[model samples]
Target: MKKRSMAVMAAFALAAAGCSGGSGGANPSSGGAKPADSAPAKTEAPAKQVTLSYALWDKNQVPAMEEIIKKFKEKQPNIDVKIELTPSGKEYWQKMETAAIGGTLPDVLWMNGPNIVKYASNGMLMAIGDQVKASGLDLKNYPESLVNLYTVGGKLYGIPKDFDTVGMWYNKKMFDEAGVKYPDGNWDWNAVVEAAKKLTNPGKGVWGIAADMNSQEAYYNTIIQAGGGVISDDKKKSGYDSPEAIAGLKFWTDLIHVHKVSPTLAQMTDTTPIKLFESGKVAMLWAGSWNAIEFAKNEFTKDKVDVAALPKQKQQGVVIHGLANVISAKTKNPKEAWTFVSFLGSKEAAEILAKTGTVIPAFNGTQTTWVKSTPQFNLQVYIDMLSYSKPYPVSKDTSKWNNLETEYFKKAWTGELKIEDAAKQVATKMNEFLAQEK
Candidate 1:
């Protein structure tokens, strides 16, 4: 799931005052004991009904997921899929970790770039490479980066479900009010800074931008554009200490600390940057494609905002990442689970997701449907960005360095440490974590 999805889910819960995902629930029909790992009997006896648990995090996509499930059910009537929702990213992963340790992981579950290496390396996940080959599934149907993402040590553990890219989501009204030209494909970092200065109105309690701690949507893109990587290609070294990486980190801090065109850490914490942008208090927000659902649903932004290609620095760039569906190595119902996971990765499933506008289905050629799903906005900007976008950076253990990023960067964001200092500290600690990863 995209980072923004969790924040959006929290907002949705607050509005509804509420909150499946897997921590393992017993199936009375299948008994609480493990079943033998044998392929379905060749004769297909009785077609006994079997229930498989499917875990995912985004509540906003549940409707589309259910539609896909309906399609799956139509094909396999004897197989029942139980949708388990874990609305919070933190809680979802915690539960998944516990379930993994207990060998009670759900039959099928959502997987992301950050955790793929950890789970797959530990032998907690079942590689679907053989299954894909046997099924004649085209690996070319998905983006090569995403296919490579789920591939660990020559084994494929998951299949791409959906993908996302970052863009500059801006309020046109604010741009017009400030007499600043709207952002476009040609705009660069300097252009944005100049425009932001004109758009900022301190007396009106408005900011030109919201530079928060969202790496996927913000710094990561800039860092790569600046010719720095988060990790070495071998995934054994840190790049945060490099000059290019430091430049990327400084770009954001300068906006808040030096330029004074963005909200401070405290101000942002009071009300999220998303709320500020939606409420017309911030002129622009660096957001991912996952935000389309939330922005379209929110009354304040539905008709007021639009997106453009992210401004370039040294080069035009953005980060692309996607979610995948994987089956547990310990699943009691491997055949049924693989069936569901296979369906999840099918073009039929992609079309269902596309029509709903829930995500950019990873299946090749389906993005056009998603692009047309929201005609009001230039949704094509996201697809257009693919030409120059880089895969989101990750290592065997992305969360280790990712966590340190928030920890050390907070000092710079809060004005307690220089951007260079924070970045150097992050680099030092991140290197330690990278070294520890086998």
Candidate 2:
């Protein structure tokens, strides 16, 4: 849900004290009584005071982060952490890239799946595998997919912070008004279609769903549910042109064009799908677990919304993505940065973040509080979906192909290009990019 960044091993070494012994007897020339042999008092050196810069995009999570920082301060009084909030993911990444070029990147920052490989391959991130091992931080404490997500070229560059998956969010009031059965795990694409048809009301200006062209929250999950994938497992080719992918694409496009049960691309562009759903203009929204806090706080939708597993297609599946905390390779306070990063990844930090309801903490066994944070909604759907979730697809230079996806998919969504043709074109271009990665 939140786009982010790696981990560092903190190594705290207490300054060892040295002892100097005096002669048992004083010098006879001084005429002083024999002085007993005594060692100088041992004193440990004070730890060096270090300051670390932590960058993140989500302002909503700042409170939780600050709370974590407060606890970290008590543990390491010498280390001072400052939070830099960028607010926008696009601007955040752009700034990170510029900072990387200038070697002024933050000591610690959030890293996402799409940018991890690019950053790690370019040596912009510190390889923390050895440090993590030396610190005795068990990688097994996190999901294997997430741990593997931050690992590049046999080296781990980050530690997972949190994970998210998609679910179908529906307005209970709308469902009740339409007298349609609420969706559940058993519902498939056909059931979704039938429900959408029954729920659409042109007079009241309410759409059955908001079929936004979001990769993670919308089409990606459907693509996987349809038994399709965006890229091959080997990362050597594209799967966009496959019939299954097309079917997945059609599921959204048809809702807009054939079924007339969703808003058009232009409408969604003007007002985001989340806003539409929040305003009660859309009956259902496919969104990520990250929306829980916002939805729970919204006045209009707070008590009227609930989530269910995304309707099944060929099989049950969802796209799983997460944020990791990583250290900049250029950081001046490498040890201090690692110390803070290590603390952030600890179960203590995870529990703190979980109770805040800001995110589903990646540390195993720490998500129950987060789920319970919003008791009215079935937040557990997100955690349950993890069992069958597919890791968000990515590769070296994912942004290049990602841009291409947006460019061509827009044409398909607007009906300027047919879904089949657009998908094939994307596949051809994506394959070219993949080949170049070799």
Best by lDDT: 2
Candidate 2 accuracy as lDDT: 0.80
Give candidate 1's root-mean-square deviation (CA, Å). Answer: 9.7
Residue 170 in candidate 1, Cα distance off native in Å: 0.5
| Clashing pairs for predicted structure model 1, backbone only | 20-84, 20-85, 21-84, 21-85
Global fold similarity of model 1 (TM-score)? 0.88
**Tens-digit lDDT track of model 2 for 83-198:** 99996776787777767755688999998888787777767799988778677777666766777788888999988898888899999999999999898778999898889888
The RMSD of every model to the true structure, in order and in angstroms, is: 9.7, 15.5
lDDT of each: 0.79, 0.80
TM-score of each: 0.88, 0.88
